[model samples]
Target: MNIVAVTSCPTGIAHTYMAAEALEQAARDAGHALSVETQGAAGAEPLDPAVIAAADAVIFAADVEVRDRERFAGKPTVTAPVKRAIQDAAGLVAEAVRAAEERSDTAPAPSGETAPLDTAPAPATKVTEGAGLGARLRQWLMTGVSYMIPFVAAGGILIALAFMLGGAEVAAKVNGGTFQGRTYEEITDLSALVEQAGYAGVLFKIGAIAFSMLVPILSGFIAYAMADRPGIAPGVVGGLLADAIGAGFLGGLVTGLAAGALVMAISRVKVPRALAGIMPVVVIPLVSCLVIGALVIIVIGQPIASAQQAMTDWLDGLKGANALLLGALLGLMMAFDMGGPVNKVAYTFGLAGLAAGNLTVMAAVMAAGMTPPIALALATVLRPKLFTPAERKAGEAAWLLGASFITEGAIPFAAADPLRVIPSLMAGSAVTGALSMQFAATSRAPHGGIWVIGLIGKPGLYVVALLAGIAVSAACVIAAKHVGRAVPAAASGAAAAEAPAPSERAATVA
Candidate 1:
């Protein structure tokens, strides 16, 4: 039977695609013709509308509401949560088809003068809560984070630039101060010193100010994504509450979603007919903000500030050879897990240090972070014989991603052999970290490679630092690969099995 499906989840990241895959596979396994559209962070891209129109039935597996419901109005439509699509997709599809058929049979034939389907209220969508509240909340938070990335990058670089400018003009200010018989004149007159100092101070401050509200904005958007226009007010209010309560970005995200949920839930409680729409949009958001804000400011804010400060202080105090060691360790952590929390923590710490005039630390961190992927990439390119056909191909592709400093470029390799591979990665990153520190390398840009010279300090040393790290990582990876076979798949067998069944067979071939 011809079938169309749409899959979505609150996060619009991993799960959305996962659900679609499960449904598609189920359809194939059951020998039904199928096409699926995914509504995700990138937005909806359903199978061709014509296909959907011609299909015998449509299935919607979503947590967040899917738009364009009018298109499937008269078609037999099966509605389900993303989880059901994943957990028991075949059964769910059958049930959905049955439901659709029943609806189709019961509805009266279209009259000569038909009412437009578009004018009718859409069918109710479904959500799966199987992932637990925390998981769901975290996904909602990511929506905000995804939106906030550009703003942070823009604001951060501009502020960093301001610092560079100030550093160049410090000498003049100091000279003027000295000429006026002020000892501070010298400090102000050294442009390089002033600019550096300013970068560490005023420029950073500006960036911080610009980014301070980032979490709240992110939280608000996540709510918006979920509830559409109705989610806006509660999301904003919840974000503010998170900030007040000592909630960091994560907290803001949670509060924003919580606020949206609260508003939505409150809206469901009976209200005067005229006030129904306004209740959620205005009254609920307002009440949520007041409650959340008061609790956050009074209880949460100080702890969060103290925690952030402590983290900053720890990085600030990192010095000499140890600084390199610390950076190396962090870099290894980043590459080992791709973009997991461990990686994010290391990256966040490195960037935070950029505002403290400790660019060397950051330089080591960045160099080490990208070394594993890049090194492996190079190894694959230079000695194709060293890897399996699949591995070599992957390595070759990883090169471009590595060049752009995507640590996860090596994830496929690591996942295959965590025990052996992770150690190799650490060794390589440590070497890079140590060398960068030894060379006193400094960087201005939080990320970027050779092309970012104008944005970094001690470009020559930075290049050397990176080269050293890459060389070390490459050597380690190559040596390990020659000595070690592809990682034992015992641990990952179940995971690999979960890939499309065809993929499991491919793994066997490899």
Candidate 2:
């Protein structure tokens, strides 16, 4: 069979490409022609229309809805989550082949006159895969988070830039005396802002606008992950209500889940073929939104707002020892896996706090995350003999990686000697985290590591904490190396040949 397929994951980074490769390999093994589009962070080129038209079947392996889904309309299609494709690409290929054959057997005979390219968008046959409830929920939330990150980076960096340009006085004016938030009604003309605080005011306004979308995007995409495109409207509208009512990110989480659940339930109610086309586009979104709006307004709003406020109050009231302990815990998480799931958890928590006007969490998270790569790089420099030639090369790159807040640069070293390197990195990161909190070195930016020093509240203190962590981690690495096996430089040819490349498997943290 000839198949046209699209693969997309939440972040559209590693997994999208992985799934595409898996499907291609599966198709080739099965003696089928396959055209696959990978929709990832950098975006994707459209597959040829002719190729799509000629395909016997379509495969949608995506967490988010397939863009331009109508292009595959009326095709015999098989749909599964992107991870499913990675896990069982051969099964998906076989299923697509079956779907194509089934359609060929059932579809009406070809006629002289052709139907329009854009016709009723039939729901693709969804394939179920095994995963626990907890795993599925985590995957769904990650879907939301992955989509939400670009907004965080762009908005947070722009706000940081605004502060750099306008300084304290401009921040005071634009923030309406506090960072908790300022009303949209307070927005003034760009010309007027330029007259007042120049470019800084304009940037702050723009950044603020971008930051405002954090909740809706998170909610919408979470729903999108569960129910694809049909869930977006309800989820986004519910999120807007959540934001307006002071329910914040917590509320966004609830609404996203609720909207997704509602859409799924609605989709399962068997409608006539005549109504099926309209169901996804109109009835599902309309009904879900109306119910969700009512639910938020009448049942959940006040309680969630109160909880959000209480959490904010607790964060605001955190004192020396309490703050230090929190920072240390977060730091440990940051360095625990060097930009793996644990690191992302810490990073995501920091982002949540940044949105809540609690800047210290962001500061502590970044400082701790920066520790591992910097420390590893420093160790490689101080004891070059302890590392292989390739390790040394990786270490050289780690300096810039660590500085830029890409923690996975340290992964190659960790993979080689996890027992020694990981603990030391964690210890040093904890120290940095505690100190950052103690010094009250705050940052509005979610990332940009050392480069964003100018925007940090206590830039000097932050640098001092970072350096201190680097020193401690480096010392620990040197001490632990004494117990490890001989360096890769001493390895036999086959052993050395089996080693993985430093850049190949490293994860990117936003």
Candidate 3:
């Protein structure tokens, strides 16, 4: 069999490439030829047309909409979430083969028109709605986080740069008297702040504008993920209202989900042929926005705002051991499964706190998250013989990935030896989180590892906490390896030997 597949996820980081590698290996193991296209945030590497034409079946393992899906029109198709491909690639391929055989024998539709891109076998709606309630909620939240991250990175880094270039008061200086009491748009005299703060003033303004869009973008894209194009406008509007009403990130999440579900329900309404044309463009947006906007403003706004304020106050009130304990808990969660659902839950919690103006939680979470990869990298450097040559090389790459705060860098190591690796990672992560909290460290940006150190409230302490975790984790892994070699070498060596080489593991998981 010849197979063509496309893999994607909302974040376009881990799952996309993991699924591709899994499919390729599974195909090879099954004595079939497979070509995979990865559509990710880094961009798409599309499959050749010749490969597509020769393919017996197509598989779409995605969490986001596939681009240029028309290319697969009329192909026997199997669609599943990207995680399924990673976990059971062989099964998916087998299913696709059967689907292809059935397709080959079946008669075509009488009209002879190819099914619409979205109407392919296993439509996205079925894929999402078929999942258990918990899975569906996680998927929705992750969709929002994935879309919100780019804005956070850009805005956070820019703001950090502004502070680095100027003094700590750069924002105040830029906004205080620069425009002579005029608004940013209405300010005609750019010369005033330019003369006072130089380029820093300009950078601050730009970053502030970007920061302002964070909530709206999160809400809009969440809706887009849920209801496709029709959900965008209302979602954004709802987010804006959330912000205006001081409902914070939690409220933005609610608005995004509510707007998406409302629009999806509205889209299913029966309508005349004349009205159908305008439903998405006109009726959907108009009705969804009005309904969502009214509900948010009249019923939801004040209560959510009060809750946000109370949460912020509680976070602010945290001191000493209370903060450290919270940080430790968050850290354990982060390293428990690397980029899995447990890790995402911790990250989402941090993001929620950040939206409420509590940067300490984000600081602790990121520090903990970065520790596993860095620690593993350090371990390989300290004790190379314990790891395969391929793993040693992956460790070198892990340094960069860890420095960038891409926690998925550690996934390969964890997958190879979950029992030893995961526990060691969690220990180090907990230490890092506790120390960071103890020091009262804070970070303005949600992403970016060491590169955004300037944005951290206590840069020196943050680095110290990170280093402490790395050392602890590295030591733990080394000790685990040594102990395993002594106690379970005979029993575990065969399974370890059967595990794929480090390069293969990296390709599949990284």
Candidate 4:
């Protein structure tokens, strides 16, 4: 089989290349001709048109939207997340091959004026029959998140800068009335300090505007993922209504799904050839927006808003042990699978809360997420004799990885010694989470690990919480290693040859 594939992730870092490498190796082993394009932070290498034309099928293993997707418009395509390709490259390739065969079987018969086999490609139709409901839903959610992340990152970083440069009162200055009814422009002329504060106020206002659009963008893209272009308008409109009604992120999710489902249903309706061209441009967006807008505004809006408010009040009211318990649970989930679905779920929960201006949960999550790699790195240093040479090298890399908030850096250690390492990691992460919550730390940014510490509400306590977790987990790992049989350096090196590289198995978080 001839196959062409593209792999991308939101961060366009490790997972993109990992998936590409995995697919290439799998294709070679399976005796298939393959070309893969990796879309990474650095950019992409365009696939040769000849190769794409010759390919029997296309695979998209991406967590973000594929660039120039129309290039594959007439091909049978299989889509999955980049992690899926890394974990099951061979399986995915095999599925793509099967999809190609199905596309061939379903192709329209050749007309009287026949063309050569190579010249006549099958009509473009995505092959999603193999994707289960859960997979599809996950893909939709991830698509939304991938699109929404930039807004959050930009808004958060800018807000953090405002707090740092303009002091905490910058928001008040931007609002005008709180600064003795003086406009920001007038305040800037008052004094040097006031001028600096005015600049900060500008940053705050811009960031707040971006932050305000986060939910609506998330909703729009999620609908686009499910029903393509036609779903976007309705989804955005519905999301705006969700916000107006105080439904929050929860409301955005509801509207996104509802809009996507409505668009899909509408797309299935038969239309005359003359009207078909205008359907997507006019009928679908108009009818779907009206239906979704009305449903969210009149029927479900108040109930969802009330529920959201109740949840917000509960989170805000959590104190002492109750907050600590919730934090610990979040930490455990984040550490349980490194960058897997469990970790994503925990992270997503934090993001949702952050969108609602509940920063404590995000702070706890980030703290917990940073613990595993750092703790393992500390353990490797504390007891070098217990670790193999390869483990020690990986540990060295983990220092930077952990500090950068890439939890997958600890994955190699955990994969090698799951029984002992996992429990230690969970223990450390939970401790960090609890401490962060107890300290009432808050974070505006969704990512950037230790690099964003300056943005933390209480940087001092956050550091203490992080260090405490690292120390506890490091101690626990050291003790566990003392009880277990340690592999000698030479034997461990020989064993490493038989297994996949640790980097290959490590998942990426964005």
At residue 108, candidate 2 shows an lDDT of 35
Ranking by lDDT: 3, 4, 2, 1
- Give the alpha carbon lDDT tens digit for every residue of 43-147 in model 2: 798999999989888888876657777676557567666877898999989888876775565433132111111110111112111122432454355456545
Model 1, position 332, has a per-residue lDDT of 67
lDDT of 1 by residue, 1-510 (tens): 787888887678877788889888988888888788888987777578789768776777776656665566545556555776888789866755564454355443232111111111121101111222332333344345444544445444444354345442222242332211223434433346436345444453455455556666766756654454456666776676665554545466566666667656665577787986577457876776676566566566676667656655565466433655676666665565554444555667766666566677667777777677778778767665554333454576555445545454565455334455677877777777777767777776565444355656777776776677777777777677656333211112111111112222221111
Give each model's clash number: 26, 0, 0, 0
- Model 4, 1-510: lDDT tens digits are 999999999678899999999999999999999899999997899999889989888888876557776566556566666888999999989878876775576443222111111111110111121233433454455445445545655665566567566654576565443222333432433345435556877777777677677668767866866776677899899988876775545467678889988998998788998998898789999999999999988898666556545544454454334888989977887787675445766777787767667899999999998898889888888777676555676677677667756676665566445567878888989999999989989987666577667778999999999999998889988888765343322222222212222233233211
TM-score quality measure for candidate 1 = 0.42
Off by over 4 Å in 2: 1-139, 178-186, 271-278, 308-433, 436-460, 466-510
* Cα misplacement distance, residue 407 of candidate 4 (Å): 18
Q: Rate the local accuracy (lDDT) of all candidates.
A: 0.56, 0.69, 0.70, 0.69
Compared with the true structure, the alpha-carbon lDDT of candidate 4 equals: 0.69
Could you tell me the lDDT of residue 272 within candidate 3?
Answer: 96
Model 4 earns a TM-score of: 0.45
Candidate number achieving the greatest TM-score relative to the actual structure: 2
Cα distance off (Å), candidate 2, residue 453 = 6.4
